[model samples]
Target: MRLALVTGASRGIGRATALKLAQQGYRVAVNYRKRAQEAQQVVAAIREQGGDAFAVQADIADEAQVMALFQRLDEEDKPLGVLVNNAGILFTQCRVEDLSAERLQRVFATNVTGAFLCCREAVKRMATQHGGLGGAIINVSSAASRLGAPGEYVDYAASKGAMDALTKGLSLEVAAQGIRVNSVRPGFIYTEMHADGGEPGRVDRVAAMAGAIPMGRGGEAEEIAEAIVWLASEAASYVTGTFIDAAGGR
Candidate 1:
């Protein structure tokens, strides 16, 4: 069975992507940092649907943890066929000038460094000629990178911008090895990250702020999941170093 390793698989886009990949016949390794129970629930749901899945915990920001996570996957006898670098954290709401060095480091640690660590490991395993078919790395980015996310969370936007750069550069470097690298930049999706920001109603606030979007509403996690699954599948064999925007016409 093809195996997929998805970080932050406990909720939102990450959880939705895990379930979607399982539905597409990929045995999924659901990676979570602290939400063990929620991760298990995702695994259980996939298993109940007759799909192969298991939960693995790791903080993607830590190099040792990321290495160990991949080592564990190797031990499972499932060389990774796909990787989704979805684990990330947003900084507390504050202006750019008010952003502390600590907050900046925390966001980049998970958003940029974490994705790079996982991508590096995935590339090592997938680029090998003996590791079944070559794999793909899909980084989950944000449209805020372009929107500039002023006033609210520019730090988060900058972190995702780094992810975009990683997507482009890494794709070119690894294209010859049959490992495709790409990114999916989603606009204002309803997720728990915003809930933790204390405004569980962020989607509505976003819609109010960006009123010009043609789609007229925020996106759903399932919507982004479908895009992610397609990019990882053979349907996008010719696509690499591309950014699939899941924004509702923003």
Candidate 2:
């Protein structure tokens, strides 16, 4: 089975995607930063379902750590076929003017730089030019990039916007090399990430407001995982440099 690595897989959409991919016959590498136990739980769950998975630890924001992460993947001797750049960081809600450089760096370091590092490694292994089979890259972005997250985390939104740009450019750069890059932009999904933004019920709060979400509800991590998995599957063989907005018509 091809190996699928999902960063930040200890929880939320990453965890959901890891589990779903395992069910689809991929050996999952559940990557986490400080959530070893949670990551192990995901691996355990996959095993319970007769699937293959293992937890890997690394801080995607650090260059050395990222290198080590891929080295660990090499020890498994599985040619990585799918890289889900789902690890990201967002600060508490703050207006752009109130945002600090430290916060911006922290956000981008993980959300943008970390993803680029992973893409670099994935391409090296998956590019046909590198004498390996082709593969797919799925970047987990946010609808906030387009929405701007005004009066909230504009910095986080900007970081995701950068991610979108990276997805498009990298897709074109490696398309002919047997690599396909795509992104899934999720909107107002109910996850622990909201708590990071200082609002545990942020999705519900937004959904409660009329017209905030056209679906009159928030989405689930599993729903986002579906979009992500589809983008990585053979079903999307001809799809690249594109986005799947699983935002409930928003």
The lDDT values for all models are 0.91, 0.94
For model 2, residues 1-250, the per-residue Cα lDDT tens digits are 8899999999999999999999999999999999999999999999999999999999999999999999998898779999999999887898888988899999999999999999999999999999879999999998989989899989988999999999999999999999999999999998898898889989888899988899999999999999999999999999999999888777
lDDT of 1: 0.91
User: What is candidate 1's lDDT per residue for 71-137, written digit by digit as tens?
Assistant: 9898877668999999989856789989899999989999999999898888888885645468889
lDDT, residue 39, model 1? 98
Best by TM-score: 2
- Model 2, residue 135: distance off in Å is 0.4
Weakest ten-residue segment in model 2 by summed lDDT = 90-99
TM-score of each model, paired residue for residue:
0.97, 0.99
Cα TM-score of candidate 1: 0.97
Off by over 4 Å in 2: none
Tell how far residue 65 is off in model 1, in angstroms.
Answer: 0.5
